[model samples]
Target: MKKDDQTVTEATALHSFDAMLTTYERWAQPCSQTFSRAALDGAALPVGATILDVCAGMGALAVPAAELGHRGWAIDVSPGMIERAAERLKPHAGWSTEVMDALDLHFGDNEFDAAFSVLGVVYFGPETGTALEQMVRVVRPGGVISVVNWAEPLGATFFIPVSRAVDRFDDPEVGKFVAPLTEFLEGPQLERALSGAGCVDVRSESVSGHFAVPSAEIFMEELDSVFQVLPQYRAAIAKDRDRFRDILVEEVLLMASKELPPARANIAYGRVPTPQETVGSSGLATS
Candidate 1:
């Protein structure tokens, strides 16, 4: 991506995240925390390993890594997110946070023992591979690079109600409002991205869990908090927010009665090849 386009993308992400900052912990952090722990387990990093958390929203992954005695940097595009992450990491030393773009990591090459992102880089759209490449670039050869992304079908259960609600609206643009948030990368696709970025021994596995909201009312409230940040959603409902909310609530309530399905994620990890290992793989190498 061009520098100008990167800047625009960062600004847009910052705006959306800042708006979600208020309800983020209550609505999203629980699931993020679950995935973060899973990612850390999958990484199997040595204690005290230096780490980098790309697009580290609210320090979900960083906090767990710190508890495991791993310390490093947590970076996000939103100042608000970095600020919140900093607050969460204050209890643990040797950890810092910065408002940085994942596609443009500022740290030196091979500076970290491991680097990871949890449901963060998948939103980069066409720039997703660039983001993964940056993560691979900063980790030491033989160090781990890990990421957790929502898997398809099951990964999208939570949003099904939202899509159903959008269908109630006559405007076609209503569908576009939720499109960005619903896109997901499957396990094989994630593995390819990592391998394409020069990571070896790549592996991906499916992780499953539940999303438990107390009630439909809470679900709608959380969904509303998220939608408030999305300009497309705002524009789509500009005519009658109340009516849309009502329809959304109805759809959510109906879905809730049927029991929300298990949420599943693809946790993928791979290692950067060391020079000796790289050479060994090439025919030019001699014993």
Candidate 2:
């Protein structure tokens, strides 16, 4: 990403979630609480393990991990978010939160016993390729790596049209910001990425959960305000703001007419191969 693009991304994030910190937890309550435990369980770290929570927002998993007897180190790009997380997690001695980009983690090699990013990695898109590599590099050989992404089959249906609309109207330089939205649509693709990143026994499973919003209009409102959609669609919003919102409203209202569950997602799990194991003649390691 270019410096300008990075700047825009950072600003957009700070404006979106950081600015809305008062409402983020309430808005995200359903999904975060529903899926966070599964993510921690998937890591299956023993007692006292040191864990990294990438893109950690509001210390959702970070605080809980500390309570579970692990050292939880959390990082995010938003200073406001870091501040809020630090405040919320201050009472817990086993946790700490920092402001940093996930793609350029500054920690030394094998610095963590395990690492996980829940729903957060998806925002980084293919950039997550580098983020995952960073996780692999920092975690000790054989440490577990896990991520939870919005699965296409169930989760994307509600949001795809909105993302597509943004990409269609946004500047060409941005080049399909929604493309990363489908990065983990297929479990096999995610598994392959993990394998390519030198993770062994890679596994991705569709995890089902539900979001209960009062109405379709409220859903659209929160989707635009609470989530990071505003940043991706910033250009379009500037170009014709109300029209963009109208388009999303129309689409979401149509989906809501179905009267089904509001949301669902998938979780992918893998482990960095231990140093004693050889991956292939390619000079990597495998479990």
Candidate 3:
């Protein structure tokens, strides 16, 4: 992506996240906490290890790592998110949050024992590889780099209603809205990205969990906040916002009434290669 495009993407993401921050913090806590634990477990960090949480929204991963006795440095593109994370992490010593871009981390080489991003980074779109490379660069050799992304099918579930609403419009431009919301990396695809970023012994697995919501009405209310931020969603409904929302609300309520399957995620992880290991693998000898 060009620098201009990347800047626009970041700005748009920050805007969406500003609107999403409250609902996400409330409705997404259970799922975020669960996935954070899974990512940390995959990293297998020693206690007191220095860890980095890239695109660490609201400190979901950082808080758990801090509780595990690891020192954590969390970074996100949104100042609002960093502020919220700082508040949550204040009680823990050696835990901090910074407003920073994932594609260009400010940390030094091998500054951390491990690094992770949970339900984050994949949204970087075309810049996902660059962000992962930054994560790999900041971790010490032999340190783990882990990330959790929503499996495509599971990721699409929440947006099914939106898709249905768009279909009612029968317009190509409106249909484009579904693509961005549902296009997520599967396990193998994610592994390729990680391996390409210099991680070795890369592996991924599906993790199943669910978001805890009390009722369909409340769920729709929280979710509507999310849709409002999507520029495509706004544009699609511009001609008939109320009609679109009505259809979407009805679809969501109906879907929620049924017994939905647990949300599944792909958690990929690998170790950074040590100098000796790298040389040995390359069949090179040191002087």
Candidate 4:
């Protein structure tokens, strides 16, 4: 992908994450437990099916799917995430890993029985309509495509408050962050987008994020991991790195203390519409 087309400072973000992936994966087990269950429930893949895990960070579901009667092709954009996925899925017989973009996935038409993204697809790009169409296109007509993402920001980490804090960026083609005023990429927008993208019986629900963690220590670690995107998080704030960290930490602590509400999710799933019908949906930027 072109430098401008990808997420900002992805290399630095990877390095920042190198030391934390293992810790975060371990810490993520609890959250993953919740997401995986909800994801499967939402997508309801048939056994012995082929699946694609997009933005398959660290192969969380890809690795498990190997042992769960399904095979998966795990594709990621981040080199670091791909590296970690390789290591994690090494012993899995039904898993393969590759580096790719969600916006433009490389697969023949109707390539798999199902596709699932876990809290991924946070950034569906400027053409969410096209991205959703692409993701749906990869699945068989009667098969399923499910996307998992935070519907709102109620806790320590989310693109919402930070987007609010910043001067309302309009970079819809890349980052998950966007102006609250934008009508094309939100709750109702998501439903319209999915339906428009030719996904039938499309729906979403609240899943996971309500349970507590082993401790606040693990939570803090994950917080720090994502915040390493200081430069990308708040570009101006990063001008004075130390000061930025302090400000971000204080704001996050406040959020953390605010009773980490259950994570809300929009788990949309439906049969991939036939290509003929897919061409007729009416909508724009329904991510």
Candidate 5:
């Protein structure tokens, strides 16, 4: 595929997630939720408040939030994901699912008391800043916006498969990572994206996890959904698949020694600055 065509195709893969749910939820939930609730704890949002779960795959955090007595709305771009989330949350009240998107959330301004994302809000490509601003837009003043994303240049255990899969890309012209790549923000990027969006009191952490598995085969098998979404690797070699599986196995064994945390980037929690707050030259507001 041509450069533009490849990126466009990859973007489509990233957004479409029907075929990959089983694998995604199994590996993603452990850390997605662990970091999600941890980030919320850092922000200290009220338990009874209304919450928005953006990019909420299979309602991992949504179900828990509802169980906690918070009214929750879970949004995803995949109908399959929506259906799955609905099924998962059906037995519980106070939670609903929608096939809407995070970038173009349908809620009104300040419509929610708290908005949280787990393994979401990282794949905006060129439009990341705008999407994050959108997340901030839907929250009421003093409400919390928290996000947990995978850190990039992943360690050997995680990066092995990702590197091989990324290398399988047919097009060499596309320079930036198909998704988060090295965009795992820690300091200034977080400040700019959050505070720039009028969020305040941002606190973050560098948390990690080690996913135990029977074997590397078990681990690599779980990545089929993301592989399907990655257009570059969709046409990948069978040998490449083996290599990815093997690499992950080797890395897993290595990381298992230290522990196989899913290699998370950060869980950032910040509040929307009150209107009386100041907007600084860098898009940050100084109260």
Candidate 6:
């Protein structure tokens, strides 16, 4: 990605998350818990190990890692998110948070014992691999790296309202604030991203779960809060705020009325290769 595009992406994310600081966690409790659980489970983090949580929104995984006795370092683009994460992790001495870009992690190579991102890098449009490589760079050889991304069909279903609303209301020339979820949906595509990032022993699994959403009205409110910062979304809202809200609410209710089961997410895990293993496999020696 160009430097300018990176800046825009970061700014866009920061704006959206800044808006969500107070209410996001409460609204996302269900999906957040599920994603964090899956990422942590795949992590299998040893107690006291140094772990990095990239795109660590509100410290969902970081707080738990700290509770589990891991020395946790969490990063996100949004200052608001970092601030809230710091508050959540304040009780734990081993936890810390930073506002940084995931695609350009500043830590030295092999700095972490394990690293993970819960639904983080997959939204980087075409720069997902660049972010993943940076993540892999920070992990110690043999340390685990895990990521969670949405599954296609279920993800599409979940976001159908937003998609339809955007198509109908937003200008076609405007760019998407968030990339299509399907960009990172397939399991093999995720595996390839890990392998391409130089991670070894890559594996992926599906995690299916549901949120006991209270009502369509509430669900629509929370979901809308997440992406209102998107230029196009904001533009559409400005154009016809009430109609946009009404349309989205109606569409969300249609899905909620069906009471569909929880959709599945694909979780991937991989290990950074040890020096000896790297040498044996490719005749390459470590520094």
Please report the candidate that would top lDDT against the real structure.
1
Model 2 clash pairs? none
TM-score of each: 0.87, 0.76, 0.87, 0.70, 0.79, 0.82
**Cα lDDT for residue 238, model 4?**
39
Candidate 6 TM-score to native: 0.82
Regions more than 4 Å wrong, model 5: 1-16, 155-180, 214-222, 229-262, 284-287
- Give the runs in model 6 whose Cα sits over 4 Å from its true position: 1-8, 153-158, 164-179, 214-223, 229-236, 279-287
**lDDT of each structure?**
0.78, 0.70, 0.76, 0.61, 0.66, 0.75
RMSD of each: 3.8, 4.6, 3.5, 6.5, 4.4, 4.1
Candidate 3, poorest ten consecutive residues by summed lDDT: 278-287
> Per-residue lDDT for 85-152 in model 2, tens only?
89878777878788988878989999999988777765564476777888889999879988776665
Stretches of candidate 4 above 4 Å error?
Answer: 1-33, 153-187, 211-225, 230-258, 274-279, 282-287
Cα distance off (Å), candidate 5, residue 37: 1.9
Q: Against the correct fold, how does model 1 do in TM-score? A: 0.87
* Count of backbone collisions within predicted model 3: 0
lDDT per residue for candidate 5 within 116-188, as digits (tens), equals 8776665555555666788889998888887766665442134454554455443354222354244545644
Model 5's alpha-carbon lDDT is: 0.66
Which candidate model has the greater TM-score, 3 or 6?
3
* Superposed model 3: Cα runs more than 4 Å off: 2-8, 153-157, 169-173, 181-184, 213-221, 229-232, 279-287
Show the lowest summed lDDT stretch of 10 residues, model 1: 278-287
Query: Tens-digit lDDT track for model 4 on 152-180?
Result: 54222343335433333323322444332
Ranking by TM-score: 3, 1, 6, 5, 2, 4
